[model samples]
Target: MYDSILVPTDGSEGAEAAARHGLNLATAFDSQIHFLSVVDERSYSSALADLDPTVGEQREGFEQQATEAVECLEEMVTEPPVTCQTAVKHGVPHEEIRSYAADHDIDLISMGTQGRTGLDRLLLGSVTERVVRTSDVPVLTTRHEPDRSRYDRILIPTDGSEAATAAIAHGVAIADRFDSTVHALSVVDVGGVVGAYDAGPGIPELIDSLEEECEQAVTVVEEECENRDIDIVTEVVQGPPYRAIQEYVDREGIDFVSMGTHGRTGLERYLIGSVTERTVRTSDVPVLTVR
Candidate 1:
């Protein structure tokens, strides 16, 4: 369903990985690919005084670097034969990316969760984090090299919230495009409940209730999958949501994860809960965050 896919790069290893994955997706959808490398003008200007006579030359050098980074990505697009374009923008990295996506009608923005330096603290950079928080479109992030093979299994973690519903649409779109099987997971946060209460006497009943809720959540995902004519497998378990998702990804050989950046319950549960933040930091494959 993606029309124009944007891949913002800074010539980092992480960005290289994202470019591969983005190209794969574009090839699959037969969509146009746009490679954007934004020059952080603020960083350059601060590092080199604007009053300096050489400052203009330094800016030109930065633009040249951006062009070279985009060319590298373009060279990698030959195997699947996707239409590719490149651009260099000057501004804050995240804002430039968001603005380009909006102005260009980009369907998705695929980026690295980390950069060469401290741009990304752990999972993603401040720019990536801000884009994930504010972007109107889905943002696909990768911390590892892309598998390249068509995703055989795609994971969709849900909590039956509006945000999760939005994520489902993106997940189903990708799964449908690749003809991949969808695994819908709903985790019961029994640990959260136990932490909130001192006694374990009511833990069993609470766990049971959480499982019931999990079932309802997965049912919502199942119905969506059925509507899309995509194959689906469902699971419900009791544990910390992020751990549950990571464990499931490893256990089931999940190639990708699609979920919301924030959940309807706010900061309480997984699938955009704190769990999403943790999962992004630790996931071995790409994680797609839709808001």
Candidate 2:
């Protein structure tokens, strides 16, 4: 379904790993590959002050790195036999990424969760997290390079919200393209409810309520996949959401997880953090976050 794929590079191992997966997807779908390198102008002020007075050494240095990074990605694109384009822009990395995708009609953006030296350790790297939060299109992220073949099984986690339904559409589209199986999973967070209560008097009723929600969530996926004639298996389990997703991935050999940024749980839950972001941080497989 992708027409053009964008890979933002910073000449880091993490970015290179993401590029590998992007190239593989581009090849599979016959899509063009676009490379972007944004020079973080904010990082240059102090360094520029120390450079030679007559020379614009810092700016030139950043441009050179951006150029080389894109060139290296271009070379890597040959095996896939797809057209490749590159650009070096100077601005905030996440803003530049979003702007480039819009201006260039990029269908998908594949990136790494962490840069060469990302600042955040407790959450997703700054630029990536921002892009995931704001991008209008799907953003695919990988912690490590993915296999060069089709995804074996794609998982779509749902909570029956509009955002989750948006993810379900993308998941089905991708699964259709690769002839892959779709795993529709909904986790009832019984642990979350139980942990809030010191005593277990109302826990069973609460668990039952959550289980009903899970069933409805899974039904959303089931209906979508059914309409598309895509093969799908559905599951509803009770546990912590992120842990349940991770365990499901390992148990089913899931190679990709496509999820929404916010679910039926709403913005408040995402404001604190999200199961989606946590999964992105911990999933060994690639994640495609759709907003």
**All candidates: TM-score:** 0.91, 0.89
Point out where model 1 deviates above 4 Å. 46-51, 79-81, 118-124, 200-203, 266-268
lDDT of 2 by residue, 37-118 (tens): 9888775664554566533576677778888888888889766557899998887788889999999999999998877654
lDDT of 2: 0.82
Per-prediction CA RMSD (Å): 2.8, 3.4
Please give the TM-score that candidate 1 achieves against the real structure: 0.91
Task: Note the Cα lDDT for every prediction shown.
Answer: 0.83, 0.82
Candidate 2: RMSD to truth: 3.4
Candidate 2 Cα outliers beyond 4 Å, as residue runs = 46-55, 79-81, 118-124, 196-201, 266-273
lDDT of 1 by residue, 1-291 (tens): 888999999888888888888987898888899999988876457466467758767777777877888899888877645788899888888888999999999999998988756422212366777887889999988898875658889999987778888898888888998999999999887767777788667777777777787899899889988998999999998787888899999999999999988875632365554677677767889999988
